[model samples]
Target: MKKVLAGLGAALLLFVVGLAVYVASRQHLKFSVPLPAVAAATDPAVVERGRYVVRNLASCPICHGDPKQMERAQAGEEVPLSGGFEFNIPPGKFYPSNITPDPETGIGRFSDGEIARAALRRGA
Candidate 1:
């Protein structure tokens, strides 16, 4: 009985080690889109168009808008894109990321290319 238990424990340990190695090996995934060296568009018209697309087209307000005035946002009232909305899904509550350009809590430091890649690949 002791030997059987010991053998089982060893098998479990080997399985766990193998699983860890597999996971670590898969960390470096090859993506279809390479990180582009694009810069942020600074033209006034382009900026306005981006804002319009986010406000009207993208579901940015629903997921990334301020939680305090979420109702107004859902009703199409323009609210600050603060992104504190808590989603109560199957796993539990999840507060989406702040989409503001506040530098610390938002996407201020990220380059335009990195932001676009994340948005395209991970739906950030």
Candidate 2:
């Protein structure tokens, strides 16, 4: 019984130490961005096509919240694309950002290439 208890205690200690190391290592992770390839479209047709892709094909509004606002967007009535969705998980509470063109709370500060990269690839 004594030997079994000692082994269990050692195993528990090892687990705790391993967990601590894993959490600490997460703080030092480096993010790398790739070079931009394509520029954002300026033509009205291209913009409309992108909007159609987002609303009808991609189902962005499903995750974005507000069916009525989504409907307005679907009708092409220039609705705000500000995202404020929250996803609760074991690691942390994940809040999706407001993606509107508003400079303060959205992706307005990001360049067109930056937006394209972020939309097309992970960790951009």
Candidate 3:
């Protein structure tokens, strides 16, 4: 029994040391290459295609709603996606930003490039 306990303790110590070493090694590592930049869309057709992609493929509507109806739609909902959702992490609340097309309440004032950057680059 004593031998078994000693063996278990040694195993635990070794595991903790291994984990510390791995974390320290990761802290010193650096990326050697930069991420490639997305190309800009020039043609009107390309811009329209990008809009379609953002609307359908990206499911932007799931978070942002029709600007005029957003207030009524979110009145009773807990996870309205207009910035009122609780996250498990940090033991606090997290809310999704309103992506509506309303200039005052949503991303309507943001330029196309800014929107694209938020979507593709910042993952916001």
Candidate 4:
């Protein structure tokens, strides 16, 4: 009985070590690479189309527009997008990043591609 128990314990220890080694090795594998860049749009119509797509389909206005304005929308006020809203996170804190086009206060310095990367690609 003692010999049988000793052998079973050794086997379990060896199995756990082997599983750890396999998992550690698998973490080093490469998955994918970045794609090549596309051509820029110089046409006004293309720009307008892109803007419409972002506003309606992507729903960029939801986070970027003023929270007060969104509330007023229910009451029939035609409030233009002017972003300033706080996002609450648990464990006791919150942050509100400005999204308005105001140069001094918001993302006026970022290029269109940077914005697209953040919104579309979910890249930081």
lDDT of each: 0.82, 0.75, 0.64, 0.66
Tens-place lDDT per residue, model 2, 1-124, is 9999999999999999999999998987887777577778899999999989987788666565444576776676655667756778878987656787778988888887788777766644
Query: Could you tell me the lDDT of residue 80 within candidate 3?
Result: 29
Q: Candidate 4: where is the Cα deviation over 4 Å?
A: 1-40, 71-81, 92-96
lDDT of 1 by residue, 1-124 (tens): 9999999999999999999999999988986767777777899999999889889887777788888997787787888777876788986789878768779988888888878877654563
- Judged by lDDT relative to the true structure, which candidate is superior, 1 or 3? 1
Which has the better TM-score: candidate 3, or candidate 4?
4
Better of 1 and 4 by lDDT: 1
Per-residue C-alpha lDDT of model 3 across residues 1-124, encoded as one tens digit per residue: 9999999999999999999999998986754433345556799999899767755577654555444445664563323234433345676655557765668877788776676667666564
In candidate 1, where is summed lDDT lowest over 10 consecutive residues? 115-124
Model 1 pairs in collision: 64-83
Number of clashing pairs per prediction, in order: 1, 1, 0, 0
TM-score of 1: 0.64
Q: What is candidate 4's lDDT per residue for 53-81, written digit by digit as tens?
A: 75677766666667868877446453445
Q: Candidate 1's error at 49, in angstroms? A: 1.1
Winner of 2 and 3 under lDDT: 2
Candidate 3 stretches greater than 4 Å from native: 24-29, 35-38, 61-124
For this target, which candidate reaches the highest lDDT against the unseen true structure? 1
